[model samples]
Target: MRVSRTFRLPAAAVGLSLTAVLTLTACGSDNATDTAAGPLTVVASTNVWGSVAQSVAGDKVEVTSIITEPSSDPHSFETTPSDAAKVSDASLVVYNGGGYDPFVEDVLSSNGGNSDQRTVNAFGLLESQSQVRDQGEANEHVWYDVGTVDATAQAIADELGELDPGNAATYQANADTFSGRLKQITAVTDGIAATQGGAPVAQTEPIAHYLLEESSVRDVTPEGFTSAVENGNDPAAADIAATRQLFTDKQVRALVYNVQTDDDVTRDVRATAEAAGIPVVEVNETLPEGLDYIQWQTNTAKALAAALQ
Candidate 1:
């Protein structure tokens, strides 16, 4: 996980000031009406959440995602004046909060955004979920956690329903459908847990923390190594040696590699895993081209299962 950059206002020539009038009125405001001329609009920080919003909103909403390219790191993503205007004019803004996408929070705080803008935060939802919350600090990668995504999907539906009362039923129905599909994905991870609970694994970064937790795999990745990588620093030589030992010794059943943030250190770790005949499963922060959220996660869960086998 890369650190989120501090957001700064774009130049005035970019037209941020013009978006002040586009602010979304608070939900249930007495004078409020559907603010969009066509379908309702949802601006999401990344395509992963954008895909979820679309599933619940169906055809009644137009969704725009800021980080659609897989190569773009969400943490270091720079917001444009156009992005601000999109959020300002949107009926709902969905983001992975919890420091995962600071740019979104920055855009919300600038003059163009409203404090009352209807927004769905995945990390915030995770904290509120008693079923999922634990004593440990929660992972900011909530999208990989099935429970959080399900809750977020429902939250999006409720917000959309409130914004467009006539389509409330449709929004809710879509959420139900989306949740049901999520359960199917959960079942796959549950099966992995039931069959191979506590299987040892290692990761290049902590990006798949929740996913591995759901599958009941014991992650043996060195905290020092992952922390250093996440903070955009190189791991200490001792930590690097220890991580390589895991691969050379074949202590872990598989290596979960984040293909997005490649570096010489990670590449060597991956190469070590391959030389030892340990399965290397590549993971990404965003959806792959031609795949939706469900398909992408489903593939990840199954790939882990296969690697373990």
Candidate 2:
């Protein structure tokens, strides 16, 4: 797969509507399977959770991710009726809730079969475990939260075990193995935390809130700038100037750039950081092609650590 930058327009520019589902049949059996008679199936909101579900599922179940393309942002994902059908028919549905992938919730809410379908919501799991460490508002990107990702993997195993009792032990063992690897990934951040605690950085958005927080790096980006970027609105002139000052004044050690949501303003900020000799660590919301969850996250943590060093 080719690795290239994906510059996305504002979410509002891409209309978030279920018009295709309305025009097409609302309940077709495209890629939908019967778990009782045929192979068990798991549907995830995006490949990030899908990779976790697949790790726990092993070879016993078929996992499908609605947003498979690296360029597709789950926040603005447009679901179809066929995608709804897959969710309804799946033995288990894994998603990142907490308003991250509202389309998944919209599909489940509209489908009557959702009542019988099993689900593992990563954000919901984090809330239930009281693992949200943000001061006021929680970050919806729970996949970046290592602990939450571990919990989500185990939750998928539990759900799959209940659905396919014969493979319960296999599911549990796979989840354990997956969790072990996740620990290794966490250790990298822990190392960074111990050595680079309180080191200041800048972000184009709060995409890596959990990872950066875990590593104990301070985000010096103005709240107004990140908030505006996340909301798909341009920041005020003062907010923009404040953010640029972080780079020009050498207040930040690095810039955590989300490569998926690029725009002119963010591009300019990145350029400023580059010109100031601040290392920029690029991150993605979805899994890059040809790489699994562990590999992708390991790269992220290592990249952050290297940038800090």
Candidate 3:
């Protein structure tokens, strides 16, 4: 989720700044002690990455997601003491960086440094792989990008192996299986693009911009409008007018709406799109319940492809 305001440290837990939180290292004790006796404990910033970790780790790891509540806006998520404890006890930590989940960083910092903990920052990994630069300029919803999500799954497997060498082979095998499923998702996206290439779409925000791009859909939403809404600010009057025009004029094939981050403006946009007979495909930042990462992406791709058709 896009963050407009900085998350404040709870009044009881004061004096922690964003810079201080970011500087906290993930490294913990080098003794190779498991956070727990039975399974490796993994903490993810949101259920999106948590689902990926769960798939890669299989039954060998216990995954906990900080943002599992569908109604919660991750941008305004406040950290709790229990969340900090979870980070402190986790053997592996996976988070979407790029300022999308600074609360994760803050939680890690408040729990103190963990030198032995294996960390995977999805945004940082993407940047290292040259997938994106300047998280602010790029879409923070990296999971929507099949290639990036695949890379993140591999990264999670690698970190799991490092944290638990005994399960290294299992991690590799699981990662390979997960990667295959991701490739299938890519093929599905390619198929859609082949049929609906250059189709114009409008979005309330850039939540699924990567997926839309992968499917070769042209997002005609004004950049100013999307940016403003994403940052929790009111869009410029001209941008709002242009966005409404895109719907009323039926210039787009579909409207990809962020179901998790709805507001008055977005509601009106959706109503207008529906009135124009444009299909509205709902997307979310968190993985839906009862579905893993692959399932969620596959289902969304199918819905989008159908809408375009």
User: Could you tally the backbone clashes for each prediction?
Assistant: 0, 0, 6
Q: What is the Cα-based TM-score of model 2?
A: 0.89
Predictions: Cα RMSD each: 4.1, 4.5, 4.3
Model 2, range 171-237, lDDT digits (tens) per residue? 9999999999998788999999999999999998899998998898998899999888877778999
lDDT of each: 0.82, 0.81, 0.79
Q: What value does the lDDT take at residue 245 in candidate 2?
A: 95
Q: Write the per-residue lDDT of candidate 3 for residues 46-164, one digit (tens) a residue.
A: 99998889888899878999899877666667666556656666778899887777767766665544455578888776677664433335666788877777788888888888778
* Predicted model with the maximum lDDT: 1
TM-score per candidate, chains pooled: 0.89, 0.89, 0.87
lDDT at 234 for candidate 1?
88
Per-residue lDDT of candidate 1, residues 138-249 (tens digit):
8788899998999999999999999898999999999999999997678889999999899999998899999999999999989999877876788999999999999899
Worst 10 residues of 3 by lDDT: 5-14
Candidate 3 C-alpha error for residue 37, in Å: 6.8
